[model samples]
Target: MKVVIYRVGQNQYATPVESIQSIERMLPIRPVPGAAAHVLGVANLRGSVIAVSDLRKVLNVEEQAFTPESRLLISNGNGYVVDEALDIADCADDAWEHVGEQKVWQRGDQLIVWEDLQA
Candidate 1:
């Protein structure tokens, strides 16, 4: 399957390319009251306002300040903040292994994790 891979610290994560509506640069976010701990708040993309979540928090990774490479993966009107947007790669179905609840791909010394942000 073709996937868009992104980083969250030293770790890499992937999601099906078709699953996300668009990949955008990090935008200014407005805080939302009574939102989930993982939710970063909301962002205005173009003219649409969407909720944004911290992928680092959701993936239980170390949180860091957004850098120039930080990105927003927009899916179904929701946005997920990631450390950086990596690349779009075609991964074979057999390359993926089910590791507990995560779909993981081991490429040499690096491991790529699959996340269903659309879910």
Candidate 2:
């Protein structure tokens, strides 16, 4: 399957390209009261209001300040903030190794966490 590989802190992750609508630059987000802790809030992108979530918090990683490399992976009308958009590659299904609950892929020294954005 083809996947969009992204970074969160020093770790890398992958989500299927088919599940992503677009990869966009970080947009201005308005915080919503009483929202989930992992949710950054909503952003207005091209006249569409979409809720943004912190992939760092979702992955239980340390949150870092948004940098120029920060990107939003838009999926199902929602956005997930990631450290950077690294690459898009075709990965064989047999390449994935299940570690407990996570599906991980090894690329030399780097390990990419495979995720289903639709989940």
Evaluate all candidate structures by whole-model CA lDDT and list the values in order. 0.91, 0.94
Error of 1 at 10 (Å): 1.4
Candidate 1 local lDDT, 54-81, one digit each (tens): 9889888888999999999998899999
TM of each candidate vs. truth: 0.94, 0.97
Model 2 bad stretches (over 4 Å): none
Question: What is candidate 2's TM-score against the reference?
Answer: 0.97
Off by over 4 Å in 1: none
Candidate 2: tens digits of C-alpha lDDT, residues 1-119: 89999999888999999999999999999999999999999999999999999999988999789999999999999999999999999999999999999999998788999877778
Best by TM-score: 2
Lowest summed-lDDT stretch of 10 residues in model 1? 110-119
Q: Whole-model lDDT, candidate 1? A: 0.91
Residue pairs with clashing backbones, model 2:
none
Error of 2 at 35 (Å): 0.2
